[model samples]
Target: MQLINYQMQRFWQYGGFNPDLYLFIPLSQTRYVTRGYNQVSQTWSPVLKKHSNVSEALFRVRATKAQSTLSRAQRKRNLKDAFSLSHCIQGKNIAIIDDVITTGSTMDAAAQTCLDAGAAKVWAFATSLTPLLGK
Candidate 1:
């Protein structure tokens, strides 16, 4: 928690805070049930509670296999049309938060879903970035 707080503070210092909304990547019902919580949400909840702009505005409408085993192209295909917006984010700037980013296909799908729901712009933040093989 201390590390997350430090990172959040650094993000604020760098002017990466203050998005209109903070949207955590939604886990599928199956995954959520299996895991009992979304780790990203769990980690960000305290800071987000202070800001009061945290929202579960997006949800997964379909399930996909664990991304760790997938190739980049397969990851993109797996996430296609997997998310749905629960409310209008019209003209709002959104920041999608996640624990880690690998190929970024998941974030791309989430951003596209937000755009489809009328978000003005979307930015993504992750605690870690996993380098792709041979990169």
Candidate 2:
């Protein structure tokens, strides 16, 4: 959590701003049931201020194969139509938080969902990034 806070501070300093809303990447119902809580929200909730509410506007409509087990192309294909927005996000600048970024397909798909729902802009943040070795 501290590391996320420090990184957020640095990002804000460099970008000269913070997001209007924070959105945690939603896990599928099956995954959520098994995990009990969203790791992204659980990790960053402590550092987020009251003004920046964690929005549950987005949700996974269907389950897909885990990104870790797929190639980049498969990852992108697997997330197709996987997410849906619960409400209008018109003019909101959103930051989608995830615990780790593998191929980034998951976050990309989430951001697209927000944009489709009328968000002004969307940004993706992860605690760590895993490099795609050869592709």
Candidate 3:
């Protein structure tokens, strides 16, 4: 968590990614029930709360196959309309945080959802990025 916090701080300080609100990618109900907590939210909430508002801006509409287990096409298909906005974000700049990014389908879907809901701009941040492998 310390390393992630450092990187996130650098992203804001050096990368100049200031946002009106911070949003963490929500876990599906099924996954949340099994895991007991959304690690991404748990880890970053306190850190972000001090500087910016942290919001659960979206919810998973349905569960899909794990991204790591899917091909690129399948990854895109799995998240289609999978998230629903939970609150108003009109004209707000948002930062969406996720634990890991692979093909970026998840972030794209979330950002698109926010955009469709009238958010001014959306930026994505992740603790790690997975190298793409043969689908």
| Alpha-carbon TM-score of each model against the true structure | 0.90, 0.90, 0.90
Question: Candidate 1: how many backbone clashes?
Answer: 0
Task: Give lDDT: candidate 3, residue 88.
Answer: 93
Best by lDDT: 1
Point out where model 2 deviates above 4 Å: 133-135
Q: Sorted by TM-score, highest first, which candidate order results?
A: 3, 1, 2
Model 3 shows how many backbone clashes? 0
Residue range with the least summed lDDT across 10 consecutive positions in model 3: 43-52
lDDT of 2 at 95: 88
Question: What does candidate 3's lDDT look like per residue over 1-135, in tens digits?
Answer: 788778878987898787888889999999999999998888777678677478787889999788889888898999999998888999999999998999999999999999999999999988789977988
What's the C-alpha lDDT at position 132 in model 1? 74
- For candidate 1, lDDT tens digit of each residue in 1-135? 778788788877897556888999989999999999999998889866778888898889999888888889999999999999888899999999998899999999999999989899898988789877852
Q: What is the C-alpha lDDT of each candidate?
A: 0.89, 0.85, 0.88
In lDDT terms, how accurate is model 1?
0.89
**lDDT-sorted candidate list, best first:** 1, 3, 2
